[model samples]
Target: MSDKRTVLVVEDEEMLLSAVSMEFEDAGYDVLCAGTAEQAYDLLRARPRVDLLFTDIRLPGQLDGWDLAERARALQPDLPVIYVTGYSNEQPRQVAESVLVMKPYRMSAIIDVARRLGVG
Candidate 1:
Protein backbone atom coordinates (compact mmCIF):
# COMPACT_ATOMS: atom_id res chain seq x y z
CA MET A 1 0.00 0.00 0.00
CA SER A 2 1.18 3.51 -0.66
CA ASP A 3 2.06 5.87 2.18
CA LYS A 4 0.30 8.76 0.40
CA ARG A 5 -3.37 9.36 1.08
CA THR A 6 -5.66 7.77 -1.52
CA VAL A 7 -8.56 9.61 -3.20
CA LEU A 8 -11.13 7.83 -5.34
CA VAL A 9 -12.56 10.20 -7.93
CA VAL A 10 -15.68 9.18 -9.88
CA GLU A 11 -16.64 11.21 -12.91
CA ASP A 12 -18.17 10.31 -16.27
CA GLU A 13 -16.51 12.98 -18.38
CA GLU A 14 -13.12 11.91 -19.63
CA MET A 15 -11.43 15.28 -19.57
CA LEU A 16 -12.66 16.21 -16.12
CA LEU A 17 -11.68 12.83 -14.77
CA SER A 18 -8.15 13.12 -16.07
CA ALA A 19 -7.80 16.71 -14.91
CA VAL A 20 -8.94 16.05 -11.35
CA SER A 21 -7.08 12.77 -11.05
CA MET A 22 -3.91 14.42 -12.26
CA GLU A 23 -4.31 17.31 -9.88
CA PHE A 24 -4.73 15.03 -6.90
CA GLU A 25 -1.83 12.85 -7.97
CA ASP A 26 0.34 15.91 -8.39
CA ALA A 27 -0.68 16.99 -4.90
CA GLY A 28 0.87 13.74 -3.60
CA TYR A 29 -2.30 11.72 -3.32
CA ASP A 30 -2.72 8.20 -4.63
CA VAL A 31 -5.68 8.69 -6.99
CA LEU A 32 -8.07 6.00 -8.19
CA CYS A 33 -10.15 7.10 -11.15
CA ALA A 34 -13.54 5.64 -12.04
CA GLY A 35 -15.59 6.64 -15.06
CA THR A 36 -18.78 5.18 -13.68
CA ALA A 37 -20.47 4.36 -10.42
CA GLU A 38 -20.00 0.64 -10.95
CA GLN A 39 -16.26 1.08 -11.32
CA ALA A 40 -16.23 3.17 -8.16
CA TYR A 41 -18.07 0.46 -6.29
CA ASP A 42 -15.64 -2.15 -7.53
CA LEU A 43 -12.75 -0.09 -6.28
CA LEU A 44 -14.42 0.43 -2.90
CA ARG A 45 -14.90 -3.31 -2.54
CA ALA A 46 -11.41 -4.15 -3.66
CA ARG A 47 -9.48 -1.54 -1.69
CA PRO A 48 -9.40 -1.53 2.08
CA ARG A 49 -7.68 1.79 2.61
CA VAL A 50 -9.31 4.56 0.58
CA ASP A 51 -8.83 7.84 2.43
CA LEU A 52 -11.32 10.04 0.56
CA LEU A 53 -14.07 9.98 -2.08
CA PHE A 54 -14.61 12.79 -4.57
CA THR A 55 -17.57 11.89 -6.78
CA ASP A 56 -19.75 13.76 -9.23
CA ILE A 57 -23.44 13.50 -8.36
CA ARG A 58 -24.60 12.67 -11.86
CA LEU A 59 -22.92 9.51 -13.06
CA PRO A 60 -23.63 7.15 -15.95
CA GLY A 61 -25.10 4.38 -13.82
CA GLN A 62 -27.99 3.39 -11.62
CA LEU A 63 -26.35 4.86 -8.55
CA ASP A 64 -25.42 8.51 -8.25
CA GLY A 65 -22.87 10.08 -5.97
CA TRP A 66 -25.27 10.31 -3.02
CA ASP A 67 -26.06 6.64 -3.26
CA LEU A 68 -22.40 5.81 -3.73
CA ALA A 69 -21.53 7.84 -0.68
CA GLU A 70 -24.12 5.92 1.35
CA ARG A 71 -22.75 2.59 0.20
CA ALA A 72 -19.19 3.71 0.90
CA ARG A 73 -20.16 4.87 4.38
CA ALA A 74 -21.55 1.45 5.07
CA LEU A 75 -18.13 -0.03 4.46
CA GLN A 76 -16.19 2.80 6.11
CA PRO A 77 -18.20 4.93 8.46
CA ASP A 78 -15.79 7.80 8.87
CA LEU A 79 -14.91 8.04 5.20
CA PRO A 80 -14.92 11.64 4.00
CA VAL A 81 -16.78 12.50 0.78
CA ILE A 82 -16.91 15.63 -1.36
CA TYR A 83 -19.78 15.77 -3.84
CA VAL A 84 -19.63 17.59 -7.18
CA THR A 85 -22.81 18.52 -8.99
CA GLY A 86 -24.03 20.92 -11.63
CA TYR A 87 -27.68 20.74 -10.65
CA SER A 88 -28.90 22.87 -7.80
CA ASN A 89 -32.38 21.36 -7.68
CA GLU A 90 -32.12 20.14 -4.12
CA GLN A 91 -29.12 18.99 -2.20
CA PRO A 92 -29.71 15.43 -1.07
CA ARG A 93 -31.10 15.80 2.41
CA GLN A 94 -28.86 13.10 3.82
CA VAL A 95 -25.69 14.74 2.56
CA ALA A 96 -26.79 18.33 2.95
CA GLU A 97 -24.08 19.08 5.44
CA SER A 98 -21.33 17.53 3.40
CA VAL A 99 -19.19 19.45 0.95
CA LEU A 100 -20.90 20.17 -2.38
CA VAL A 101 -18.94 21.82 -5.19
CA MET A 102 -20.82 23.22 -8.15
CA LYS A 103 -19.90 22.37 -11.73
CA PRO A 104 -17.82 25.51 -12.41
CA TYR A 105 -15.97 25.10 -9.15
CA ARG A 106 -12.34 25.99 -8.96
CA MET A 107 -10.24 22.86 -8.42
CA SER A 108 -8.39 24.60 -5.63
CA ALA A 109 -11.59 24.98 -3.59
CA ILE A 110 -12.23 21.28 -3.72
CA ILE A 111 -8.66 20.54 -2.69
CA ASP A 112 -8.98 22.96 0.19
CA VAL A 113 -12.13 21.26 1.41
CA ALA A 114 -10.50 17.84 1.21
CA ARG A 115 -7.50 19.08 3.14
CA ARG A 116 -9.78 20.45 5.83
CA LEU A 117 -11.54 17.10 5.98
CA GLY A 118 -8.19 15.44 6.85
CA VAL A 119 -7.30 14.28 3.38
CA GLY A 120 -4.16 15.31 1.44
Candidate 2:
Protein backbone atom coordinates (compact mmCIF):
# COMPACT_ATOMS: atom_id res chain seq x y z
CA MET A 1 0.00 0.00 0.00
CA SER A 2 1.08 3.58 -0.58
CA ASP A 3 2.32 5.53 2.44
CA LYS A 4 0.26 8.58 1.58
CA ARG A 5 -2.64 9.35 3.90
CA THR A 6 -6.06 8.66 2.38
CA VAL A 7 -9.38 10.23 3.32
CA LEU A 8 -12.79 8.88 2.40
CA VAL A 9 -15.32 11.70 2.03
CA VAL A 10 -18.90 10.42 2.19
CA GLU A 11 -21.23 13.23 1.31
CA ASP A 12 -24.41 13.59 -0.71
CA GLU A 13 -24.02 17.13 -1.94
CA GLU A 14 -22.34 17.22 -5.29
CA MET A 15 -20.79 20.67 -5.10
CA LEU A 16 -19.64 20.31 -1.51
CA LEU A 17 -18.19 16.89 -2.19
CA SER A 18 -16.27 18.17 -5.19
CA ALA A 19 -14.98 21.18 -3.30
CA VAL A 20 -13.91 19.12 -0.30
CA SER A 21 -12.25 16.56 -2.52
CA MET A 22 -10.35 19.34 -4.24
CA GLU A 23 -9.30 20.85 -0.95
CA PHE A 24 -7.94 17.58 0.41
CA GLU A 25 -6.22 16.78 -2.85
CA ASP A 26 -4.64 20.24 -2.96
CA ALA A 27 -3.35 19.60 0.53
CA GLY A 28 -1.54 16.49 -0.74
CA TYR A 29 -3.74 13.73 0.64
CA ASP A 30 -5.31 10.99 -1.40
CA VAL A 31 -9.10 11.24 -1.37
CA LEU A 32 -11.92 8.78 -2.02
CA CYS A 33 -15.46 10.07 -2.43
CA ALA A 34 -18.87 8.43 -2.15
CA GLY A 35 -22.35 9.89 -2.43
CA THR A 36 -24.08 7.23 -0.32
CA ALA A 37 -23.43 4.67 2.36
CA GLU A 38 -23.44 1.81 -0.11
CA GLN A 39 -20.86 3.54 -2.30
CA ALA A 40 -18.75 4.26 0.74
CA TYR A 41 -18.93 0.66 1.83
CA ASP A 42 -17.93 -0.49 -1.62
CA LEU A 43 -14.94 1.83 -1.59
CA LEU A 44 -13.99 0.71 1.89
CA ARG A 45 -14.18 -2.94 0.96
CA ALA A 46 -12.21 -2.39 -2.21
CA ARG A 47 -9.64 -0.11 -0.65
CA PRO A 48 -8.63 -1.17 2.83
CA ARG A 49 -6.00 1.52 3.46
CA VAL A 50 -8.33 4.47 3.98
CA ASP A 51 -6.92 6.41 6.92
CA LEU A 52 -9.88 8.64 7.79
CA LEU A 53 -13.54 8.99 6.90
CA PHE A 54 -15.42 12.31 6.71
CA THR A 55 -19.17 11.84 6.45
CA ASP A 56 -22.19 14.05 6.72
CA ILE A 57 -24.94 13.05 9.16
CA ARG A 58 -27.78 13.64 6.76
CA LEU A 59 -27.63 11.35 3.76
CA PRO A 60 -30.00 9.74 1.32
CA GLY A 61 -31.14 6.12 1.63
CA GLN A 62 -31.74 4.00 4.74
CA LEU A 63 -28.22 3.79 6.13
CA ASP A 64 -27.41 7.51 6.54
CA GLY A 65 -24.12 8.83 7.88
CA TRP A 66 -24.34 7.57 11.45
CA ASP A 67 -25.05 4.07 10.23
CA LEU A 68 -22.13 4.37 7.84
CA ALA A 69 -19.83 5.42 10.67
CA GLU A 70 -20.82 2.48 12.83
CA ARG A 71 -20.44 0.05 9.97
CA ALA A 72 -17.12 1.54 8.92
CA ARG A 73 -15.84 1.28 12.47
CA ALA A 74 -16.88 -2.34 12.61
CA LEU A 75 -14.93 -2.98 9.42
CA GLN A 76 -11.91 -0.96 10.45
CA PRO A 77 -11.66 -0.74 14.20
CA ASP A 78 -9.10 2.06 14.33
CA LEU A 79 -10.40 4.18 11.48
CA PRO A 80 -10.91 7.79 12.56
CA VAL A 81 -14.22 9.31 11.52
CA ILE A 82 -15.30 12.95 11.45
CA TYR A 83 -18.98 13.68 11.16
CA VAL A 84 -20.19 16.82 9.43
CA THR A 85 -23.75 18.08 9.39
CA GLY A 86 -26.00 21.08 9.45
CA TYR A 87 -28.64 19.24 11.47
CA SER A 88 -27.14 19.09 14.93
CA ASN A 89 -30.08 17.60 16.83
CA GLU A 90 -30.47 14.74 14.40
CA GLN A 91 -26.99 13.44 15.09
CA PRO A 92 -26.88 10.21 17.01
CA ARG A 93 -25.46 9.96 20.54
CA GLN A 94 -22.86 7.44 19.50
CA VAL A 95 -21.48 9.81 16.84
CA ALA A 96 -21.77 12.93 18.97
CA GLU A 97 -18.53 12.16 20.75
CA SER A 98 -16.50 11.72 17.58
CA VAL A 99 -15.16 14.74 15.75
CA LEU A 100 -18.34 16.58 14.73
CA VAL A 101 -17.91 19.50 12.36
CA MET A 102 -20.68 21.84 11.39
CA LYS A 103 -21.33 22.67 7.75
CA PRO A 104 -19.95 25.92 6.25
CA TYR A 105 -16.82 25.25 8.26
CA ARG A 106 -13.53 26.96 7.53
CA MET A 107 -10.87 25.13 5.64
CA SER A 108 -8.54 25.70 8.56
CA ALA A 109 -10.83 23.74 10.85
CA ILE A 110 -10.92 20.83 8.44
CA ILE A 111 -7.19 20.96 7.98
CA ASP A 112 -6.62 21.06 11.74
CA VAL A 113 -8.77 18.02 12.33
CA ALA A 114 -7.19 16.17 9.43
CA ARG A 115 -3.76 16.89 10.82
CA ARG A 116 -4.79 15.76 14.29
CA LEU A 117 -6.09 12.55 12.78
CA GLY A 118 -2.71 12.16 11.02
CA VAL A 119 -4.24 12.73 7.59
CA GLY A 120 -2.62 15.19 5.28
What's the lDDT for all of these models? Answer: 0.88, 0.84
Candidate 1, 6-102: lDDT as tens digits: 9999999999999999989888899999988889989999988799999999998799888898888888888889999899897573453368788
Off by over 4 Å in 2: 95-97
lDDT tens digits, residue span 29-72, model 2: 88999999989988898875788889988888888888898888
lDDT of 2: 0.84
**TM-scores of all models?**
0.94, 0.91
Q: How many clashes does each candidate structure show, in the order listed?
A: 0, 0
TM-score for candidate 2, please give it. Answer: 0.91
Model 1 lDDT, residue 30, Cα: 92
